[model samples]
Target: MDYHLYPLGDQGVLIELGEDINLKVHERVKSVSAHLEKMNWDWVIEYVPAFASVAIHYDPMKVMEKEGDSSLYAYEIVCAYVEKELEKITPSHSEAPRTVEIPVCYGGEFGPDLAYVAESNDISEEKVIDLHVGGDYLVYMIGFAPGFPYIGGMPEEIATPRRKEPRLQISAGSVGIAGKQTGVYPIETPGGWQLIGQTPKALFRPENEIPSLLQAGDKINFKPITREEFDAYKEEEK
Candidate 1:
């Protein structure tokens, strides 16, 4: 992965950390985040982490006045910071990320595509749910939509391709996957991921201040529950 710095005007810099998304790319995000937090750059306002890059925000007007009109200058400063940190890559093994249990109702109406997924994998639908809930999924990043978490650890057997034709509107909490990544939508919106099942938990609640229930670096687990339980939880909330 060639890490090239892209200077955005005077205040913003984008670091191309990698070309692929994986556990290693995820590590880069964490490394960049940890480095920026320590530098406390006077010009940097925020560091937004994506799957393979970090976008550093800054005060454009202030930077322009002090550093002149060259975007390359800003790029160099940010590049140096990122490169220095990358070079001193002392592995700080994060604790098996904090796991959050999520209850899900599988098959029937709840998991409409269960049979399809099972058929595709030459396994029973019950086995599908078992494999899904069996292991903890790592939250790699949040993108595509707010509170929409990108997770890893989906069993390869049940891994299905996204629908050729996406639904016009998918309900919030719809758990879906595109290629190898599985994620849960926070709101009803257009998407192309293969729909699997849904969760009752509110992934995003605006009134909660920090609306997103999950954050990058968190671990997740699915607990298959009954339809009755799903309805009861929803009713209880109402």
Candidate 2:
């Protein structure tokens, strides 16, 4: 219910819901985003919801026309409209998040950092795998790479620090742990998170109606698979 609205240049406004990343903050952001989406206003171009903030991209000229004042500042006009809409929102009114399952082939060459993660945590490889899969994580935001999910709800037991020297090109579908969080790499990119596993699923598809397989406020469950099964899945895609 508590939030601050600030100008984000001449045609954008940022709504800060809170300082921390938690369900409460995310709920508020989702609610505001939903309401704004419903408006379908000409000025509103895109809505980018983050962990605790929503960045709204708008058309300054359209916003000024909508406000019926040519002299009105775009930021001021957009902020006023957003404030009015937000006043009616209740964070708890947001819809329930959908759940998705991601199958991963853990350890071995696909996950070079697996051994290091197990050793640093003082646990067996099997134990690390068990702990990692046992989690039901939440999708906080999608950023970094297209459709790359920033997830939460990782258990502390298997948490591992980022690599001291990041890899130049981590293969696509690599699942990794960074401090207290876990995520998947949707594309081949440089990263530092301790690699744990690789999934055969494609997290981003530009041709699909919904480009990103995951979105804000979704849940992900990691399922374990064998190397052979991983290879088979890849073959099926060919």
Candidate 3:
């Protein structure tokens, strides 16, 4: 796998693996994470993984001291290790994606843009639902908003680009399309993605043990649920 490692904000290193958001890239994410954890690097505070890259945070003082250099030799040290370790991935370092289920209410009040999306794609609303729920999506990375999974695997026919005029406030659970991708809103935030169906599920709640509904490299399957079921879930929450 081709990769590029760069120094960022003193102790941070950004590693770009590839351009495509697919299973292959997701595997690379897991591989890199494991490799980093096993390495005896000095004072790595955090490792943030995204769609095509990994951003590593470290303590500059500790790293420089350990490497016996006044300059940023620590960055070079880590980069060398990463480049050496990422050699076609060994059998022991095989990547695996975790599967997650999200139940959604397709049309009417829940999906305000359902008709619009259907109209844009030249298909019936029912077909739109089928096309949407049919694919198994991958969580490339979480960005744009907290716990907002940057999901991939939308059908080519219904990959509607973001709205020319974005909504002022898209409520939590609002599922949307932006260019070639689709995702759900973890919190109410202004966004340009074409709003379609919604899931009653709590995408992010700090109270839960797992605060983030979707993590990077997660596999997602959208299951169509009834409005009544959604209402019941809300009622139960109350």
Candidate 4:
């Protein structure tokens, strides 16, 4: 219930639920986001949820029209409306979070930086994979690229820093470890995360009702698969 509201540019409001990135903060962010969605205000354009905050974009003209008072600024009207509605929201009453399983093909051609991660952690390549798969990961937020999940709860034993020089092109489905966090590249893009594996699953599906395969607050489980199995999975998708 504790939060702060700030103007995001001219037409948006940034709601700060908490200062840190933790389960409690994440819950509050999700709660506020859900509450806003249910409100369905005509002035609200869209709301984007992040680790500890939610950015809401609104239509200034619609807000002014709804208020029926041109004397007052649009941003002020929106802020007052948001403040009143947010007072009714709490971290409780949220629906159960969804769990997603990501199958990864580690090492070899798929993961060119597997050896580097193993060496960086002073562990064997197989141990790195074992620790990664054993982790209980959570999708905190989606950013950088569409459908790309910024995951948390990676095991400390296998943690590794990003590459010294980012690759020009990283194939879609490439799983990588950056610092203590682990994530999968949803689309073909350049990044510096330490490559460890590749998933056959498509994280970005533009044709679907929901384009992102993963969303914030979803639980993640990494499953290691063989090269043949990866190929078979990809074949099924076609």
Per-model C-alpha lDDT, please?
A: 0.78, 0.88, 0.80, 0.91
Against the true structure, what is each candidate's TM-score? 0.84, 0.96, 0.88, 0.97
Best by lDDT: 4
**Residue lDDT tens for model 3, 1-238:** 6788888877788988778766677677767876777776757888888877888898867766677744547777767666787774542434456789998888777677888888988999898889999977888888777798988888888888778888889889988877778899999888787777788888887887868989887889999888899899778866
Candidate 1: worst 10 consecutive residues by lDDT?
A: 88-97
Which tens-of-lDDT digit does each residue in 1-238 have in candidate 4? 7888998999999999888989999888888898889999999999999999999999998988877856779988888888998889867834887999999999999999999999988999999999999998889899889998989899999888888899999999999999999999989999999898999999999999999999998999899999999999999999
Local distance difference test, candidate 1: 0.78
Name the runs in model 1 displaced over 4 angstroms. 1-3, 8-11, 64-91
Ranking by TM-score: 4, 2, 3, 1
Tens digits of per-residue lDDT for model 1, 163-195: 888889888887776766678889999988767
Q: Evaluated with TM-score, which candidate comes out highest?
A: 4
- Where does candidate 2 stray beyond 4 Å? 68-71
RMSD of every candidate to native, in Å, equals 3.0, 1.4, 2.5, 1.1
Residue 11 shift from truth in candidate 1, angstroms: 4.1
Worst 10 residues of 4 by lDDT: 88-97
User: How many angstroms is residue 152 displaced in model 1 relative to the true structure, after the best TM-score fit?
Assistant: 1.2
Q: Which tens-of-lDDT digit does each residue in 23-114 have in candidate 2?
A: 88878878888888998878889999998999999998787777774566778778878888989988774366799989899999888888
